[model samples]
Target: MLLALLGVAAFSLTFPSTAWGLESFGPWSLVALRGVLAALIAGAFLLAGRVPVPDRRHWAGLAVVGGGVVVGFPLLTTLALRTSTTSHAAVVVGLLPLTTAAFAALRTGRRPSRAFWLAALAGAAVVLGYTVRESGGSLSTGDMYLFGALLVCAAGYTEGGRLAAVMPGWQVIGWALVLCLPLAATGAVTALAVEPVRLTAHGALGLGWVAAGSTFLGMYLWYRGMASIGIARASQLQLAQPLLTLVWSVLLLGEELSPAAPVAAAGVLMCIALTQRARS
Candidate 1:
């Protein structure tokens, strides 16, 4: 839970950078650069620490974790955010726990207690209901895009967390960074072909923060928590993120939104707590 919180914090801090990078360079460009830089950052740490290469026993898991979480997630999210506000994206992203819990139960053959199931469902219902109400009974295109990204992200979180359990947190993310190489390269190439960029000083600084904080540190800890605990438990931490994201959006984006943030937060949190207490 501590690790998950750290990951969430890092993500929140860098959340503003996403809009900046997107403005300077499109989402794919930012994602590609983030992947390449994150890999380099992790690799540098590995070399500095002289960490031994992971045994083959862990390779397949790393591949799945890294590919699913690192490469797949960034790409999908960047595309989703192209049309979505960070607040909108955060709402869908909040569903990670519900999705992961379901996946965990299916994978481990562990039967979550009835209370756990109800709480999880209730949380989803609250969030979905609120979203529809806020949007005045219409879901926007951006919402749908983010919803798709969240589905992909849920797969990454569940699988990556499972692998992180046995592997060291840094190693888990490191492996994912490794998996990102080819895909990132392809993305970078495509980005260059379409909209090549040379960052201004401000842009460079933003990218640096994003690489160090969000991609490297944030992602590393998230998978660490996921691996150490089951995804179902780890995902519960995310219930708080959408609220935080809304706060950030109001502060940063200057968007006046629902004044019922506290109520919504409490509802989501209650559901998370209920599910956590109910889970086997």
Candidate 2:
């Protein structure tokens, strides 16, 4: 439960750092650099801790989870924010719990209760309405990428939760970091090719957040939470993250709050309540 509780706070720090990373390179480059650094840190821990090697089955999962959650989600979401506003991205990401919940239901064939469905539906509606109000155009390339990233991340979260059920905190994420290195290297090359990124003090600080808080610490906590509380309950804690991001954006970036803040907050709160009730 504590793990679930901390998920939002961890993610809150990570997502905003996405903006910080872009100060140097494009989203992909930032992802590439961050991934390499995270992998190195995790690799050092693995060596120091004597972590076990992956079996074949572990490899299969490591591949998908690495591609889907670690790489795909951050990459897409960062790219989306390059064009879209922070609130716009926040509203969509606020629905991640609903996506994870739906995936859990599909995977387990466990029927969601009426309130679960109702809250999920209402949350989606609120997100859509918020998007329409903020971004008047039809879904852009960035939106599709963000949505796909969310779906891939949902799958990864579910699986990572299961991995946490057995593995040590460092091991599960260490393995993820280990498996993600190759692609991250490729992403780094790609990022440099496109953006020619350089490190100013702010860029370095931003990457520091990406390296430590966002990837290393945030991911570990998220997995620990999922491990302890189960994905169904833990994922619900994401409700706080978007709201927190909105608050941060307003305070830090001087972005104006939309009039619909109350409705969006209500939607997220209602969903969190319904998910909590179902879990209990």
Candidate 1: residue pairs that collide: 66-176, 164-227, 165-227
**What TM-score against the true fold does each predicted structure earn?**
0.89, 0.91
What is the C-alpha lDDT profile of model 2 across 137-221, one tens digit per residue? 4777767777887898888777777777777655676788778999899879876887877667667777788777767777788
Looking at model 1, residue 236 earns an lDDT score of 73
Which residue pairs in model 2 clash with each other? none
TM-score of 2: 0.91
Q: What is the C-alpha RMSD of each candidate to the true structure, in Å?
A: 2.2, 2.0
User: Candidate 1, 72: how far from true, in Å?
Assistant: 2.4
Residue 267 in candidate 1, Cα distance off native in Å: 0.9
Reference-based lDDT, each prediction: 0.74, 0.75
lDDT of 1 by residue, 177-233 (tens): 866778877888898678857666656766777777887898788878767656777
**How many steric clashes between backbone atoms does each model show?**
3, 0
Where in model 1 is the C-alpha error above 4 Å?
Answer: 196-202
